[model samples]
Target: MSSDAPVGARPPAGKTFFGHPRALSTLFLTEMWERFSFYGMRAILVLYLTAAVADGGLDLGESSANAVYGTYNAMVYLMALPGGWVADRLIGARRSVLWGGVVIAAGHYVMAIPTGWSVFAGMALIVLGTGLLKPNISTMVGDLYERDSPRRDAGFSIFYMGINLGAFIAPLITGFLGERINWHLGFGAAAVGMTFGVLQYVLGRRNLGDAGARPADPLLGADRRRALTRIGVATVILLAVLLVLLVAGWFTVDTVVNLLTVVTVLVTVGYFARILTDREISGTERSRMKAYVWLFLFAASFWLIYDQAGSVLNIFAADRTDRSLGGFTFPASWLQSVNPILIIIGAPLAAALWLKLGHRVSTPTKFAVGLVLNGLSFVLMAAAAQAAVGGDLVSPLWLVAVYAIQVAGELSLSPVGLSATTKLAPVKYASQMLGLWFLATAVGDAIGGQVARLADTWSQPVYFLTFGLASVVLGLAAVMFTRQIRHLMAGIH
Candidate 1:
């Protein structure tokens, strides 16, 4: 029953969602509930990991928990590369999204089981599912408009709002359920959210005219058989290696995390090498790709600090922040809601600001702004950590202010980076470029997870200040290279 129209074909002129295609509403809601499930579980993951065993938790140490959080995130994003490949060469974006949603829902339901092993098993499934779902859905969003359509950015802006709205609401509900009630129940709620997403996506498929109807580049006959065989062999080899490690007693959590971090970095280097050395791309495109490398580093740096909201900062919120209001103490996870709400409020304003500024401001300059603001947020966190030195609880407002600043930085860089990725991508690698963008986050979270171990060994103030200042210095350095980067960008704005 799926439409077989070519990709990017406009939907039949009928009812619309805010003057765009009706299908946008479908994709928007699907992404919204998917994010709801994601952020809901994320709000409580670290807290659940580090809580007392008596409190129905794993009771993992702080450093280990943070490391797990970072690795899990890295894996989720890292999978995007293969996920994109699958969509392009096998199932197409439409089916990938549907199957991904089902797997995600199943993963959350698995976590709802009250067992020590279930959480890790559930996280593995979610990582695979998210890998399939995330990038393809965004690709579908892009497919809704023709290339170079003015409405393309506006459509993505609306879609971005959906993401924030879900994120804004999820922590409030899941934080209360997980922290004040049973952690499993919170996971169950996330499962329900994803189920709703899946059901609605199925129901709304008709609205999607031809967007992601089939693979962009399908492998045929012998090629398909060969590809499947190779995938099977690789999976078997990976499993065999893991089994050997487990049998040899070297299959520790930290070891696995460290190994994956290295793998993520190597993959990034390889991907960049493949793109840069491709003889097919024109000189102008190659120049733009070179500029993209700088932006990628800037984005990776931004996420390294920004993504800690769910790990290191989440722990600080639980242990050091005062959540008491009148007679009742609020859950620490509730504070995680701050950044998204601010994003929801600030995104439009930032968009308008960018529109007004027009070509006067370059992408590198915007990225530098994001980097500086991200560092300043951490610098502020350093002060907050210092205040909590003697076991004194700081006001919840400190975290709020921190998240607000981070949101501003996110606004400055994230959307800009996405736009830049599309603009700079070589024509042949267009579909895979989004996956490369996600890899930046994978690199940051992977390395940042390792870096976060320092928090366990160093004073809180020192830890925050060190990374904070380092980011600020990197941002300033980026500013110095702005003109050079723009020159490398060739004609891209």
Candidate 2:
């Protein structure tokens, strides 16, 4: 099984990049284009829906549009689990990446058509493709290095740069085409990007060698039969439910998005219950698990707000923020670039802060600060809303300031949370713990989508204040319990 082998263990054959496997470039380029397409479509999705009918938009109601947008984004998150399952149990990661890219390109092309059906159909395809691609690509990234290789971290860091680079560039190009010119053309551009990604992936396939060439876990004949039977049953059940609800006129896209939110929360709860009750776990492991539980909550809360950068914030940027600078105007999609830019600048400073402090600050404390900062960003948003009440475009700097604060919150939480998860994971349940951690983002995005569906009905001030106060309260609660959580961590941090 590929799982037993260290990724990228084979010696380089033909070429290399930065002293690592040449395959890194293939995987890197593939992921870059994938993100480019994803964020590109995302940058314009809300804007397109809200634009006037004369402007080639759907001219949908704000509530309906926001709901669909949230649900599409949430579906992308919700599919990751099943996607990973399929990759590990059915096919290899290599094939998964290839097929996922193909599907993604097709999805983009579907969205390029100027029709109602194309909109929903395109989202569905992208969701499925992203699920397949997201987890497996990172897995292949790890596979590109031998076990404990120093080059491993550097390799991943470099690959992640591809992600940031793609995300940063996507909005500028696609946003301009979609918002300022033609929406279909913008989507067509995404298809071209993904098409290029698939082509490059094919060209570089050999560089991967045996990594992810086979599933880590293969189902035996009987097990495969049982699994298929269960899947069939589940599919039948889902369709039946969908049919009934659709006929009843209660199965709108927003309803589906909200249902996914419930599913995410339930799944996370089930995971925590399973680990805490497992008899095989050690006493110390159990304590660490308790600490993880709180950390998970705080992290989820932070993301619930931060993930709005794409949905709510994107909308705000397009309709509310002033994008002009002395006669030069910019696309709203360019606002998305602020996050990666800030992350790039602040990452080293954040690392230095931790290093200089050197254990003086506890893990839980750092998380709490992040949550508080997350809340503050929303407060700033609330202020921006207040300023815009008179029907004038708010300054772009308002959004930038909000992002700057949230990025600090992000840097403090994201890396530290991952590290803490690794330390706290029980040996037997290590992989599951990691899965649970990823679940946090899925859950956050799910909830964020649900909240964003309210963009129409809720007053801007009320909406921002509600979430802002909730985040601050959660952050303060985390801070209050920091000592107790530290005790439970049993010194893992």
Candidate 3:
């Protein structure tokens, strides 16, 4: 059978990775290392930004640093759309993954250069590379299994573990190296991680069979040329705009961040408008799309708060929390490991709980639960901030408890949101649905970055409490509208 053939249609498998195809191991490890580098760098990004110049840091104020962090995250996710397009139209997923890895490694290496400009330049490259790798790698994983196979979900679950494992370990190592030694050395560690991932991926190429070897839909002949031309033109226009901004003295970091955030929001709005106004969509699909709008808003809100772990929270750990451990002060970034570890321990339980609940619980209700949980996490954070007032160092347990609650919220909403995105996708726009799902994150991160600016100006407790209460109120509103949203879902659970 062809490599594209379903698992059930193929002859009995000879060797397998954990009773599945061997290719899974390759994908798993690749993802694990990619995440290791990604999270490792993220753990220290803000801390590096806000660090003193004497300590080989940028000395960006907290507000600008938070904005930069948010904008960077938003860009990483936003790039996935164009990244997916490039894979589909120009290169196959396999080559995209390969090239993306190469670029990512280069980006990390650039960050290791110990120059002020190098970090920003390196971040730009990483954003581009991650856009290429992130969405396409997940696509390749899906290619390993047939659409309807029961093993497909199982494969993804295994893949998910790899992601969490990487995330769980990255901070401990990178945080220690970055915080105790030079920040650039910590970045170098991340580079090594990505390099290992790339090397192993190349070595394991044989196991991949034909998965992602070719584009699902390739632009041919004139179409390909036209697409390339458009890309080139867009790049030129973007560069021109940057030149104008710089020459006009409007090219500050905050200005760039705010501009990108606006762009992300506009893209999301435009995408939804296109889908909703399409004449081709059936009424049923339209209703479901409408329901998805609500879900999308809820998800965006969740991530706005959840993803702040690296930025606002990281700063909090550094400035407010006591890290001293018997004359050995721990790196603040080490605390980042808490979320993924909790997720690793809690995921199976969450999965089992959802399985047990079955159809009795609706997606909207789960999302509502997530929102409330997320709000409560921040509410708890409010107390933590309150304790840290008057320069009193609070216990690290405060952040731990907060991350635990956020992880619970993540467990409830994230996977459910993915499933719902697939279910609610109109048949005509099926592939684009995943892009839309990612957009929700991009939108949230972009706006959240802006929202985080308030952290620098407002009292920490008030800031946490205001957002926390707002989220809780939104969750309660979601509870009130569950029936309406469900009816609009057109029977999709």
User: What is the Cα root-mean-square deviation between model 2 and the actual structure?
Assistant: 2.3
Per-residue lDDT of candidate 3, residues 1-493 (tens digit): 0113323222223468888888888889999999999999999999999999999899999999999999999999999988888887788788999998889989999999999988898999999999999888888887777766788778888999999999989999999999999999999999999999999999988888777777777899999999999989999999999999999999999899999999999999999999999999999999999999999999999889889999999999999999999999999999999999999999999999999999899999999999999999999999999999999999999999999999999999998998899899998888768888988999989999999999999999999999988888998899999999999999899
Better of 2 and 3 by lDDT: 3
Q: Per-residue lDDT tens digits of candidate 1, residues 207-323? A: 888888888778999999999999999999999999999999999888888999999999999999999999999999899999999999999999899999999999999999999
Q: What is the lDDT of candidate 3?
A: 0.91
Q: Which stretches of candidate 2 lie over 4 Å from their true place?
A: 1-14
Looking at model 1, residue 63 earns an lDDT score of 90
TM-score of 3: 0.97
Stronger candidate by TM-score (1 vs 2): 1
Per-residue lDDT for 1-493 in model 2, tens only? Answer: 1222333346345689877789989998999999899988888888887778899998877666766676676678667767777777888777888888999999999999998679788988998898888878887787766666778877877887888788878888998899888998899888999999999999988898776776667677999889889989998998898899899999876677677678778888887899899999999999999889889888888888998887788888888888998898899888988898788778778988998998899999999999999999999899998888878899999999999999999999998897798789888776445567778887787777777767678888779888988898888988898889999999876
Ordering by TM-score: 3, 1, 2
Q: In model 1, which runs have C-alpha deviations exceeding 4 angstroms? A: 1-13
TM-scores for candidates 1 onward, in order: 0.96, 0.94, 0.97
- Report the error of model 2 at residue 88, Å: 1.9
Stretch of 10 with least lDDT, candidate 3 = 1-10
What TM-score would you give candidate 2 relative to the actual structure?
A: 0.94
